[model samples]
Target: MPLKGSDSDDGGNDDLARLLSGKHAGKHRRRSRDADDDVNGFPRLRSPRPRDEEEPATPTSRRFQHRRRRGFVLCLRTPTAVVLSSAALWILFYALSLEGGDLVSIVARLGILGAYLFLSIALFVLAVLVAVFAKGIPRKTRGGLLAGLAGTCVALLIYDHDESLYHHGGYNALIFALVVMPSLAVGAAEIAIWKWLGARRAAMCHLFALFVAIFVVSARLSRAAAIWGRGFGGETMQPLARTCKPTKIGLPWVDLLPAGAQNFWAGGLTCAPAAKPFSAEIDADGALRVKCPSNDATYIPLPVTREWPQDWKLVEENYEGKLPQPFNKRVMDAIRRTEPFRIRGDNAPGMLVPRTAEAAIVTCDGVEKLVLRARRSNDTSSRTLRPPEQMTGSRQTKTLDVIVVFLDATSRRHFHRRLGRTVKKLEQANADGRTRLFQFFRYSISGFSTGPNSRAMFTGTSPNNLDTVSPVWEDFARARFVTAITADTCQDWGASYNPRPAFHFDHEMYAPFCHADFFAEDSNPLGNFRGPYAINARCLKGSRVSDLALQYAGSVSSAYPDRNTFVLAWLLEGHEGTGEVLADLDDGLVSLLGSLDWSKTALVIAADHGLHMGLNFAFTRNGAVEHRNPMLAFALPPWLADSEGRGETLKANAHKMVSGLDVYATLRGLGKVVDPTGFDDPDVRKRAQGGKNLMEEIVPPDRLCSDAGVPQWYCECY
Candidate 1:
């Protein structure tokens, strides 16, 4: 099409090439208004081209032809202009990444920003007049524009995220109206000035000027409507109006001690001395009663009181009616009955006081001594304080959203690095801090001790402090958290470990021997690469383990409500590195994830510790030196998937080493509070519990692997 009326005027399909062609260059260019040029320059038409060479037509006929042609061309151009402008606006809106809600908000907020923009443009136009007389005006003008661009870039780097830029669909269209319209207005004014100054040609400049004016008017009108619609739609709530939920999961008891007894148990001691064995028993009324079993135990009884600390209350209905306080018979027996001692003297409070003389109340001197105290008491001054009760918040204005993607264990280093990087990206994307979330932990089973006691205290803490350690307790303080909620184990025992190979938490294992599904890391392991739950009595002799896993996931998902507070558990069955494990986990995991409201909860999956596959392919010798196993799988809420600091790349495959500890930092980040107290463990503490160091420590640049083969794949395996 030719540049004007004919197809040739618009030129060939090469739009850009046709635009720059010399044939229509004059129309697009500005006629230089030099000192010699007239205000309305006219050229003599080739000396009238020898007057006789031209033919003349009747006035009426000529007038009719001109009017008809003009009408035809105008009609054609109108639709073309509308189509081109609409397409351009759409591209701009998409590039800017606008969403519908954001678009509406922008329109509403636009009024606030629009007034400033208009005033700014007016000032800019006014300043042009001043610039005409000022020396070095061009340099100053360029400097100001450059400075604005620089500031925008910096602000974006500091606070903007990919997620925020997106509007569900038409949001950005709304934003385009708010932003583009005013911008075009300013641009049009500049173009018009250039045209009048003879710096640009009237034809091309006029076309562009037309384009800008039309868009500006259209965008402003559209954006205004969007903004007004949303504001008029509803009322807004303050952040404080929202309340929190019960943060603690399982309730643990708090301990109290009798009066004066505190002094007798001091001196760096944990229990009462053997000489003065203090015993406690729950009375018929369910109140705790204490007795001194020491000879010459004439010490004053301390004031003993009971108070439920906070979160450690029974959640079930069966154990109602105020479950026996901490000093119950079970605890009393665990403390004193195990130790042997005989009382030689009465340390009882009543035994220390003297009786009144002949039913007459005899009062002593000003001191009014109530008793003549006995001697030879054992001094115990140490006191033990119980952990506080669980914390609760009012109804939440926001809820924690979660996504857990369990990955196969490959290279230890690669896994850890990938795990850490994924978590960092997820946290950065959720800067809103309105959600409480955590990723699957990257732990190995070998690091933990076995047996009922060890299982009860299951965690990756030093052995010496097992009785006093609880990672979950710390996590509750940092983020409302739960782990190993699944019911699968990743370990595979051979004929040697157990003749009739048993699952990690089989009926037998969950009996008196060990009932620690919540605490044990292996309680919920991943499925073997090939089949369902490791053991299915219903299956025939040779069923695939992957099938069992899938069935189990289906059963569990079906058993629970899709919405509610509960942990969905999974155990990757088997320690082998066979490819089957990955396939099985993915299938089962995909199913489980599909069943939840990912926007309101989080999913975390990791191993207790990893197991070593024997070269012989049968369970035999255990490997002492463990690799830095990768902590596989972490998913976050969809909204947070694009938060700032979330790296540009995403993990695609199943090979990377990511540290397990990143779990703590990731959870802290999701919880929205920069400093989470529970991450006080030496490792996570330095980052999360302190300052803004969590991002630095958890998502250091080294963790991202933007290599061609794995743009988001970390390869730090040994």
Candidate 2:
């Protein structure tokens, strides 16, 4: 039986019975009580206590309640929300930091604005599905999705790293840290969020949805700002028309040729052979001897005259110019029918005049010498002229040989590190007066590329067009110097003004002159080598180009020890690879230099451009900075270094602003060629044409890009 005044009494009895039985009781019996009594069977007593009189909560109970509330808030705070917010901030920062112009161009170039919008919408839908069907998604499927996202992010980091951005050290480090660290945090937070959603611990999945929305909005805003600020998708401003007066005078000799002949002479005859003096019989009157080997032809001799006739009356009267022969007909018709033949001067050299043209005015060493034309004949090649005896011979007092070693893409920084010891030894020898051979020089820029830079070095002018003449080799050849070139890379010549057979060099060798079908049979028998190093071990061990160049140089030096020699070895090993290739180059150069007699040689060691390696970050920028500033050093012979204060001047100018043009000018100066002005004037500086002799004059501080022949597109200097 159970006794109870209300349900409370029944519950109390049930609890007691459960405790005694150690099991739940099936039912409890009720016991009746007086209405005045309480549930515990006591008399119905006192009135209810006032609210202010109630006992306070215990410390332990308060703490437990507080912790419960805090836990509820924690459950609502989704990790996904925090990660999304962080990612948004990072993306915003990154987008804003990009160049506005570059961003706008990127949008126009990729043509992906609509696709990007679609991707955003698709991502939003995916996020919605993730929130709504989180519980339904299999554990493995969710994991795979997360893994794919992580992989995509990693790939983006690797593939999309901006080289331009990375070059700016402070911004690069900050942006990299922000992007990578937050990306990792986002991945971790995603895992936590997925677990929470699966376990039904998330209080509000809508928080993640809200975060995704914010992220997308921020990203879009950033991108839009970048594009708008860049000012892309706008019309380009038309350049203002400018009126310029021609500053340079046209050559008198150039004006003498017909329009077609002028074009042919300028374009097609770059390497035409110089005319040699033929046997001639002078008359008793000193200058009136005319003899033709063909048909034993003879014309009446004219009065001996040192000065060219101011008028063509004498020329027309003496040389049967009135005749209607195939050769004389054109000359007579050109003289009489066309504009008056303006005779600029007399005494032009036979070698400087063109043989095929109807007429030409030849000049050499700033002296106009002759006005002449080829006689009528079926064979145009068969032309004869007697050159003055005074014009031939070495112009320089002492024979000076030149060796230009072009290490492709060898950075100055790397050069100093790998070849510092050898260079130091040479410097020490010079300092101790043991050798006066090595003199290290510096250039401010290497020009835009190998082609332009090499052209600038070869010709004393900027490489704007193919018409630019590289007269240095021809000058050397004219002075009886043996000229030769050996190169591992032929692309440089192909890209620039293609080397002409006559003027560029007396001998030229290309590494890949033959087909490689029998490479295994001839060289790399093992067949393990590939890429640029696919040649035989012997060739790779010593540098094939350098070895061949040295052999050629040796042969020329030996054969023409008395005559000057010019040899150019363009080694390709430095274009790529680590220190090993550089080491090979270093050793080869050492051997080559050791074998050469430095006393009579002027050695120029340089690179067309610097290497793109870990070092040389300053010069690795995208614009002209990277292309400029290559390694240039000079080794002058003792004879050339004998000028008073010359050594000190060279040392002082080593760090001065210089270019390949100056190198060209200096080489010309050494070869004793006078400027067109007729004087070997060191003070007459033609900065644009690169006619300033580096050996004689210093570059001014106020030189502008225009003065240096640098195009506006490539000019970085203010």
- Mind giving the per-residue lDDT tens digits that candidate 1 earns over 1-718? 3444445634444665765686466433323312122211222122344568653554533543464457545433442333333334433333343222333364354344434433433343333333333333356654564354345434433432221212222222222233444665666666666758665465677688799988866666454333221210121111121122211111100001122221221121121223323443222222223354323222222111112221221121111223343112222233233332222434343221211100001111111101110111111001111123322232233344332333323322223222333334334434444232332221222222121111211222222222333333234333433211222232211111212212111100001001121112122211211122221111111222333333333332222222112233334333342212332233334444445455555555444333333111111111211222324344545444344534222221122223433443344454443124434553332121211112223332323222111112212222
Best by lDDT: 2
Misplaced by over 4 Å in model 2 are 1-397, 432-442, 490-496, 499-504, 511-555, 577-581, 612-626, 673-688, 712-718
Against the true structure, candidate 2 has what lDDT?
Answer: 0.43
Tell me the TM-score of each prediction against the true structure.
0.27, 0.44
Instruction: Please give, for residues 1-718, the per-residue lDDT of candidate 2 as tens digits.
Output: 3444435777878867767775323122111222322222223435656899853565533543464456535433443333333334433343333332332253242224223323433343344334334453446755665555455445544543333222222223323443344454565576678677864545356576779878966666454333211110121112222232212211112112232321121122112222432232221122322222231222211111111121211111112123233222222334334332222223122122122222222223222212211122222112111134423554333556777887766644445534644566556546655445423223544354566676667665575644445346666655555666655432224223434333434444432211132112223221213223222222421124344345444444544555566777777555431223444455556666677776677777777765533212222132123334466767776656667555566655554456767777777665653112222333223223644676677666455545666555544331
Q: How many backbone clashes does candidate 1 have?
A: 100
lDDT for 319 in candidate 2 is: 20
Maximum-TM-score candidate: 2
